[model samples]
Target: MTVKVTARGAERWKQGHPWIYRSDVAEEPDKTPGIVQAFDRKGKFLGQALYSPKSEIRLRLLSRGNERIDDFWWSDRILVAARRRNGITATAWRVVHAEGDALPSLVIDKYGPFVVAQLLSAGLESVRRDVLEAIKYALEPEGILLRNDSAVRRHEGLASEVVLAHGQVPQVVEIVEDGVKYLAAPWSGQKTGAFLDQRENRNLIGHQTKTGGRALDLFTYHGSFALHLARNAKEVLAVDQSAEALARGAENAKLNGISNIKWMEANAFDLLRELERRREQFDTIVLDPPAFAKTKANLERAVAGYKEINLRAMKILAPGGMLFTSSCSYHVNRDVFNAMLADAARDSGRRIQFVAATGASSDHPELLNVPETGYLKGMLLRAIG
Candidate 1:
């Protein structure tokens, strides 16, 4: 079946943005969720797209021309995404980054011999078999696990589930990233069992860490940054709200044979305030908090939260110290994030230098045309006075 869209939607596709909201769709197909040809009001063929009736995003363009979106087509796309990570020295990385890879609403992350995938749309779920086959053909992985428990699926009228789509998937899979060995929990861990997007940023912080200095990693989920900092820092404090996550971080520290990391379970915001009150200081600090703004409605609150933590961090940072801060909230754009940091720096009464700006790893490519695909943005700073 073919779907018809308004001129706005047609123009959006022409401009390289793949999503067409429901308000822009003129005619809906009679069929259920699946692939459908998209046409403009005057019957001009726009492209082929995945159609989801229940989702606000009515169409996600897959191709500009008429082409069969079969297993072979998917295999070619998957191969393209995989090829982009050729030089990455990590055993675990994102194979397909949803809209970033032009495969909207689909995410596939590789963890050693196993692969974890999330089909986050009704249309993508309808073609699950084809995607699974393509993944097998491209990666030749030992197993495939569907981590389809994301809340986004609820918007598409789909049930949340975790099914082993192919062979066996172990609960814990060990992966190496930039010479740091750690474990990924594909079955119950966060975001496909690990935070692979920050792989490169972690390495950068590790390399910038001063030897024999003290380091603090707030919101240290699994202690990825702390483990890296511990390699050089004389002592490192890794804090998180989840005790279970801290337990896993301890295991990771043990896996890497690093003894300088101290895993602590505490509220990161409160701890930051307490550390500042006590006049405590650290030579290096990392602020990698969870997304404070999940939507546009919460952006104000998110900015406040970011400012509080960042201001507190700057207050306790030792002179000539390094600070690595980041925000994964897409609603908080780079400009807003930087402005917030500038406010924090001014309010903290510290002379700070912007050392460098950072972004997601190469494996998680951000399409220039799609701003939503570029959610992760960060900065490296140094306290000069």
Candidate 2:
């Protein structure tokens, strides 16, 4: 079972990194795809690893040493990780039983009383029964859905499939955030149909709000940011190109019986430019956009896109206002991302001080050496006059 780690691969594994590149594989599995046994050159058992001849990452280490790979062990690890994220459940949460969470190739989102997962790798697909049983046993939620529709599936030579893993999920699940309510779909919406990672970000916005303030939430999918501010700010405006999202945002307002939130279904780029042209300004401006670049290949153009929007966004910020901005793209590292924000500040002729910035919840542990694993980044800035 020992998959000989070619010369340099042993060094990386010894250094605490978990991946072994394709070039480092000195042997090929007799099987084309799925989980396989791994070992050192001396035939010493290393662990089970997900193997893909197609991926640059030839091996994804699932376990090391004597650990056995089975449903019980899998479920135990998943439940322990989810229980540790007790705070995340307050706002739809990432049950991060995914590769990034050390459950490589599987990502789960807990929306309200429901849970959804995506089997992104072929190896995980082969072990689908093990993961499903683990999820059901670990978190007895109202429902569970398997949404394996991500593009990553094709890369692993697996077809996308969406099915009910357990229970029934309603179209809209109500979530309370900082004492405000929002409804998100667990089965049919965006990634897990809600942005749980931004729950803390929303709370930060509410805490930083000024009395009688006006706010703008760009790329405001479902109004989590705007609604949180609505409770404290004088007015809130949520903007997104997706009418469906805007409609849902409005529904969230209605669900909470709050009427001060305005929904804007406009091109985000044009909308920001229009705000700048009209000299319209808000006391608090939130710039939470989707991942402009998923891969490093698109990083340069993505930076330009971020710089343009942020610079314009900075232009309309009132003195003493706060700007909450974020990029969930793994390619945009914190240092590189922060520099772009600084560029926008300079271009817009605004002096801003960063109040706070952070990434995913502790449940979403970042393997120290794997930079690509920790993707979500956010910052709070005080816009100076």
Candidate 3:
């Protein structure tokens, strides 16, 4: 099958953008979702792409050439993505970061001996068997679970489901990351069992935290950051709205044999305000909230929410204290997130210095050309006054 796109779509491909919207398609193939050759309206071959008849993103460029995209190609791509994480010292990490690894609409995460994958688009779903075999051939993991529950799949006319594709997978899997132990629920946990993108950032906060001082981890789901913070801080408070998640975090703390962390179940926004009103201060603070802006329309409201918590955190920060804040919203670009932080700092009535800007771990590669491949933006700050 072949698809012919308009000049604008052809130019988008020429400019290195991977997606060609449905509106830019001049000629559509009368076929099911699968791999298809893409050409310009002028009959010039542009690339080979994964075609989804129902998606607004009609085509996702797989290769710029007419190279054979078969089982071997799939395995090779998976192997290449795996090789990129050769030196990464973690049992759980993102093996394929969708477009970040040049495998659009597909995500694969490894948790110890098991692997969880999400074929987010109908195009990818059409080649599900090939992709699963490629994962087996490349990684040879003990098991592979298809985590196709993402809301993005609906846009492609695919149903949400979680199925065990191969081998055996446990309900809970133990994995180690940067010398910290934690549990991953691949079948039910958030974003492929846990927020693997923040692996390096958690390590950063762990290393930067001062000893014998109070530390606060707001919205600390499963206590990934809190576990790291507890290693250095005399006392740590890990707050989250989900008591079930806190219980899992407590298990992680027990696994590490660390008892310095206190898990609190509360709304992070409300807690931040309460802490500020009580004049409570902390030497170390981490604000890793869930995406407040799921869509572009929610950007303004997300900025307000982000600023409110950041401003409260800044006000309650002790002199010379460290604060680590981040946003994982794809709509929240780095510039906008930084601008919001600046606004928060100005209103915080505290002198703050930008220590460092942070991002997702190395395994989650971000392409310079594709800004959407990088959604996690963060800042490490220190209070000076």
What is every candidate's alpha-carbon RMSD to the true fold? 0.9, 1.9, 0.8
Worst 10 residues of 3 by lDDT: 365-374
lDDT of 2 at 86: 76
Which segments of candidate 3 are over 4 A away from where they belong? none
Question: What lDDT, from 0 to 1, does candidate 2 have?
Answer: 0.80
**Candidate 2 lDDT tens digits, 1-385:** 3466665776776766667888888887764767777766766666678887677777777887567778898788888778778755475677774656677777877776688888877666778888888888887787888887788778777777778878897877877766888887766777777777777788888888878989888998888888888887889888999998888889888988878888988988998889898999899888889999988899999999999988998889899999888999989999999999988888888898888887765656677677767798888898877
TM-score of each: 0.99, 0.94, 0.99
lDDT of 3 by residue, 137-156 (tens): 99999999999999999999
- Kindly report the root-mean-square deviation of model 3 from the true structure over all alpha carbons: 0.8
User: What's each prediction's clash count?
Assistant: 0, 2, 0
Checking candidate 1 for backbone clashes, the offending pairs are none
Total clashing pairs in model 3? 0
lDDT of 1 by residue, 1-385 (tens): 8999999999899898999999999999885999999889898888999999999998998999898899999999999999987887789999999999999999999998899999999899899999999999999999999999999999999999999999999999999988899889999999899999999999999998989999999999899999899989999999999999999999999999999998899999889989999999999999999999999999999999999999999999999999999999999999999999999999999999999998898888898899998899999999999
- TM for candidate 1 is 0.99
**Clashing pairs in model 2, backbone N/Cα/C closer than 3 A:** 98-106, 99-104
